[model samples]
Structure formats: structure tokens, C-alpha cells
Target: MVDVKKTSTTSQNVLRAHYKTLRPPNALRGNEVIILRHAETIAEVFPDWIERCKLDTTQLYPFDLNMPVRIPQRPNMKEAYMHDPPLSEVGRIMTQIFARELVVRNAIPRQIYSSPSLASIQTALDIKNFIGNQCGAICVDESLSSNRHDSKYWLTEKDMTRLRYCIGEFCVELQTEKSSLNDIVQDMKNLVATLVQKKKQHYVVLIVTDSLAAQILYDALSGIQSSYNEPLQQLYRKAERTFPPVSSTVFTPSTRNGILVMEPSRNSLRPLTRIGETTRPDFDSEEYVDAKP
Candidate 1:
């Protein structure tokens, strides 16, 4: 059996120490944001989909994570819109285990929000149910979903390759005249700021979202700027190996005084700062992107 108290205490101490030097300049230092990735999907369903489409996963490199093997040519708006997949058996079990840990620590969130995507919704519901909290509403927001921009469902191999490098760059390259990259970035920042404000009044805010949104939000909160000129492969490789699947990132407000950030680290929700400081890159000058090409 895991010692929930000891583990939570140790994790909290580690985070408090680490963030002392690395906290972002403008972050909401005292508030806490928990970003959780949805659990693994049912492998059988995806494999069946791939077989039906005659897609090849072998073409992808081992390091190329999160690239869809196949995309629907004519994706149904309802089906393709963050198509909700039920969690795998393993995903259910993982959530239960983590939920138990949260219960033991009395860390059940005051409120829970999830991406409109089916998998994310299920993950949030499972956690709320296991924690036995009926008072807190588990609301679904489309903004949290990856389809927030109403972008297409699938991407070409070249696009996927580019995404593997830097998601920010992918956003820049894939931006349509209808949706500017600046707008997307600002929207994300706004969402984050709104959540932080909510956390100020409430105890903790839990956001269950997709990997791409999770990564982008994490980078934003940490104030790690991505360069348009950096080799996409280099950035992709670094993030792929450094982070774990089903991992959690905690964002705490920056503070000068040493007030310990007390949060339980259950399951994959460990301190991400241990990975190292995310460097700030210049994004303002269009010259950065032009210089690389």
C-alpha cells in the first residue's frame, strides 16, 4: 500500500524548493492549477479504425508521439468534434487509484472542469465519483477541447512532423486566415488567467484536457517561450523523453516569501520543474521564423 501522506508531503516539499528559483515573473504564485491529461484510450478501437483505413503506423518514428495514424477524409462534425472515446480498463483503474490517493489527502478539488472531449469528460467524472463529491459540478467547456479553433480533424505527415517539434510553431504554421496564431495564443492566456482567478476564490481548480492543450498551457504558465526558428525535431525530442504519459503539472503563483505550496502528488501528478527550466524564446519578431527558413 502506498503511504499517501508521506508521498504527498515529500512531493510538496520538492515542488516548494524547486519553484523558489524558477517561478514565473507574472504567475499567480499562491494559486494552484492542476492540468491532467486524459488516460489512455482503448487500443482495440483505434487499431480497428486504423485497419479500416489501411493506415501505417510504422512510418512514424518511435519519438513521434501523439500523431494520429489516420484521419477521416470527411470527418463528421459531431463525431470528429473531440470524438469522445470511452476510457480503457487500465485508464479506469488508474483514475481510481489516483482518486483514492486524493481522498486520503483531502485534496479533492473544490470544482472540476473538463474538456468537452468524451475521454476528458469521462476522466473528470470518474475522479469526481470516486472522490464522492456531488456538490462540485463537473462542467464541460468546448474551449478546453483541442477543437477550440474549429480546426480540421486530421493533418498531413509534414504537418504532424512539424507538430512533433514545437506545438507553438505548429499553431503558427497551421494558422488559417480565419484564425490567426495571435488570437489562439491570447485565447489560451485568457482561459488560464480566468482559471487562476477562480482558484483564488475556490480551493483548487482541476482541468482535464488533451495532451496538446496540456502542453501548451503548461508552457504558458511556466513562461517558457518557444522560438519559431528552432529545429522542430529538437524541441519534440526533448519534450517527448522528458515528460511521461498521464503526467500532471502543477502551476503555483510566484512569491518572494517562502510559503510552502501544499499539494498532493498522486499518480503522474509530480513536479514538472524537475525537468528543468523551459527557456524563454523571442516570439514577437517575425524575423525569428524568417531566419530559420
Candidate 2:
């Protein structure tokens, strides 16, 4: 039998490791606004805690990370995969749960803009449901998805072997594409500028994207100024992104508004199914399109 104490210790370690980006010594000020990825069902373990706080769901923005990526390897399949796939049922539920948590936390926004993707649109719908339909929501730019690419590479067997050999290196490359990373940072700057210009304090934006995009944004939020720096570098003294159990450390700003850090309750190591794997029906396949739910 597993030792309960050992397991608990391990779980805490895992949580700490996975969400290292939340580690503090942050530069947050009270009046400055904050933004985060969309709320997810994974945070349901502390349902009571969520109930206490309410989000400003009205101004919530769902930034889609699912922009098309061009992996330039095969002439036979020249086009890149559809990066902005629809949300899986699990993703949808998680999103709704996240929305509820935000509403409870009183972190909703007054104006919102999302990536022009169906999944983001759906998330916008949920936020509207939570905070009422009076808030502003729109898909302002396709670039918000950070979908910029003109080249590609195929992970052949040899490359896969090399990736396995040095998972950290490959994972870094996979996460840190120069073009896409820059685009995302620019998008974030735009969003922040809009908030500041509008003088909209006490508002929050929720961005939704793949883990890679999330990690990238999380790094930026933690004050990473350049994409050239390795993500795994600061995490572990001797670890890299390819290391099997990569976790981020997050630090909250020292604002009177109070900052909370939460994650999925379960410590299961199962792989998150890509949106295409579920009922979304090849949403990533790029072969067809849904009628826009």
C-alpha cells in the first residue's frame, strides 16, 4: 500500500511544481488590472472557496490559443493543422466551472474581446450567462490567437528519438517559436493598453488556449521580458521544459484586492485529450467546418 503521508507530500510537490509560475515576489499594485486564462473545471475541488468570490464575467475576454500552425514538412499536406480547434466537452465543463469561480470572486470585466475562434466564442457565451448579457463581448482580431507561421517541421522517427533523448530541449523549441511567441506578447500588450486607456480598473480578462500558449503567457505574466530565455531554465536549477513533469511557478501581485492560486484537484497524470480527440469531431482535422455553435 502507498504511504498516505508520502503520497500527500508528493501531491503537494507536484502541484507546486506544475504551477511554479504562481510563486510570488510579484510586482502587482492595487489599481493595476489583472488577467488570467479562462476558469477551468479542474479547480472544482475547492467549490466552497469559489462560492465566496465573484468574477466580473461581463468584461471577460476569451483569448483563443488555437490559431492555425503551419508545420512545413510534407508537400503532400502543405497546409498546417487548424490551430483553433473547438473545446472538448471536458474543456467546456472546465470553462464553465472557471467562469463560475470568477463570478464568485468578483473578477468579471466590463468589456471583452476574444480570439476569433468558435471555442472562445462559446466561452464568451458562458461568461455572459454568469454575469448577465449586458456586458460587451466581441472578436476583435484574429491575431489574438497568435497564429503566425510560414514554415514548419515534421517530427520524423529520428527526430522523435532525439526529442525523447532530450525532451527538455525539444519542449522548449516546441513552446518557444519566435514568431508565435512575439505575436502573443504583442497581443497581451494590446489588451493591457486597452484596459489602461479605458481606465478600466477592477476588471479581469480570461484567456483560453492550449497548454503551450498558456505556459508562454504565464511566463510573460511572471515578467519574462523576452522569449529567447529558456522557460525551464528558471524553474529548476537543472531542468528543462522537456523534463516529463514540467510545472510553472506563479507569483501573485501584492494587491489589496487579494490574489488566489488554484489548480485541478486530481493529481492524475493522464494526458489531456486535444480538442480534436473528443466530440468536437476532427475540429483540428481541418477537413471540414462546423456550422458555428
Candidate 3:
């Protein structure tokens, strides 16, 4: 299992620093975007989930007269191991703590963007529930989901790695317009641009996503340090992915007047793919398959 990261001092410092910006005494406040990593998942918290997953799925489903109705007999064990697993009991409590931190800091967001992964959405939802954000304020962004090109970035498979059910879906995968590291940066740029344009100044927005994706967002928008020598993606790959559950970084877009325009030429970006799409892969076909070892 990938090590779960604890909340960092730096993020806490940013939260401390950001509290002042939210209530500035001057003109209308600038856009404050808080990029948050999702909380711990069932797979991350429960060792027994994998043990239950190892049972033959077909035989397990047929209910017996002696079998208790709860726990392992439930349909979602395979589904939980197969698809995006929801939060565990511990994970739910962690989210509550995270939500309360936001309230205490006065960092309530006007709008929210979330990755489509079940865990990411659940994390976003818990925060919204705490602060009373309407459904309309939250959106599931395809760009914010796992990077379409990289199998490593895909969700749900992490807990099931080397397990049987995990292998099939990824065995033949189709890559998409979100093709490279540059595309990751571009997608986040577009996200920031859209929110900055749509919402009024001082509107706070929250983004809930995976940690590596959050790292990309942070490195792209927060500016790389002066001392780092490697290329951005190289540097990115080397950085540790672990971060506290629901860890966040607060940023205001680097702006000229009020908005920050970070658009690359339309030609540079992939033809826009709609949300909730699942395209098939023809492994035999000689399409643009990114088959890297």
C-alpha cells in the first residue's frame, strides 16, 4: 500500500496565512482556490477488504440460509474491491475533522470542483455537507479525474494491484486527449481560467482530487521553486506522492488585473472529451496507444 501522508506543516501554514486573505479590508478580494487531496478510502484503511475480496466472487454471491445478512454477504465487497471503493469508518471520521478545520479557518468555498473518482467525490461531498454548499456548486470534472493517459494515475486499481479483478480493466486501456504531463497542466489552467471568469472576485473555490494530480496542480499554479534544477515532469516524478488525507493548498491565481489567463493555443490541447465517458480500447489496432514499460 502507498503510504498515507499526514497533513503537512506547510499546508497548515498556508491555511494560517490564507485566513487573512479571505477577509481583506480593501477592495473586493481576489479568487482563492483551495486544492484538496481526497481522504482515506476503504481499501486504504481496511486490511480485511482484501481478504474478503480473495474469496471466489461467483460462489460468494448466492445467499445461504445460515449466512448473516450483513458484512461479507453484501454485494458491494466485490464491487468495493472492483470499482471505486467508498470511505471506511476511519476515513469518514477523518473527513469530519477536515471539514471542521475548514470551518474554523473561515475558508468556506463558494464553488467546488471534484474528480469523478468515487473517493474524491465523497471527500468533496463531506466538506460541502459541513459547510452547506448546494449541489449546483460542485461539478465532476473529467480533467480532474485520473490522467487519461497513465494507468498509474487511474483510481480503484491501487488497492487491488496484482489482484485478479484489478488486472482485466487495465489490461486493455484506451488513452485520451489528456495525453501527457503538459496536458495535465493545461487542463488545470483551463479549470482555473473558467472559475476565474465565471465567479465574481473574492469567490472561493475548492478542488478535491487525487494526490499526484493535486501535486501537478500545486506545481503548475503555485510556481516551481527557484532552486529546483530538473524539468517539471522529471521533478514531479521524483517528488513523494504521499500527503495527508484532505490536505490542501490555498492559492490565488497569478493575475494581471483580476483574472489569470493561462490558455495555451487550442491546437495544443486535445479535442474536448465529455464527462463520464468510457471509450473502448482496440489493443490489436495500431491507434495512438501509449504502451510504455
- Lowest summed lDDT window (length 10), candidate 3: 264-273
lDDT of 1: 0.50
| TM-score on alpha carbons, each prediction | 0.53, 0.40, 0.54
Q: Candidate 3's residue-wise lDDT over 136-179, tens digit each?
A: 25665657754454333334344334322212222222335656
| CA displacement after TM-score superposition, residue 226 of candidate 2 (Å) | 3.0
Q: Candidate 2's residue-wise lDDT over 28-146, tens digit each? A: 22222323233232122223221232212222122223211211232333122133233434545655554554454444545544443334444555555656654434333333444
> What is the per-residue lDDT of model 1 for residues 1-293, given as tens digits with 9 covering 90 to 100?
99999999898778553435654223223235677777656432353443333334233222223334333233342344234444555566666775664554445666666665556665776787777633255655545654444434433335434434111122223233334334545556677767655544636567777665665566666555744234544543343333333456665543327533323222223222224532122233342233321
Quick one: best lDDT, which candidate?
3
Model 1 TM-score, 2 decimals: 0.53
Best by TM-score: 3
By descending lDDT, how would the candidates be arranged? 3, 1, 2
After superposition, the stretches of candidate 1 with alpha carbons farther than 4 Å from their true spots are: 1-31, 43-46, 49-84, 149-182, 227-244, 254-293
Candidate 1 — number of clashing residue pairs?
5
Residue runs of model 3 more than 4 Å from their true location after superposition: 1-31, 46-48, 53-80, 133-136, 149-181, 198-200, 225-242, 253-293
Model 2 sits at a Cα RMSD from the real structure of 20.1
How close to the true structure is residue 195 of candidate 2, measured as C-alpha lDDT?
Answer: 42
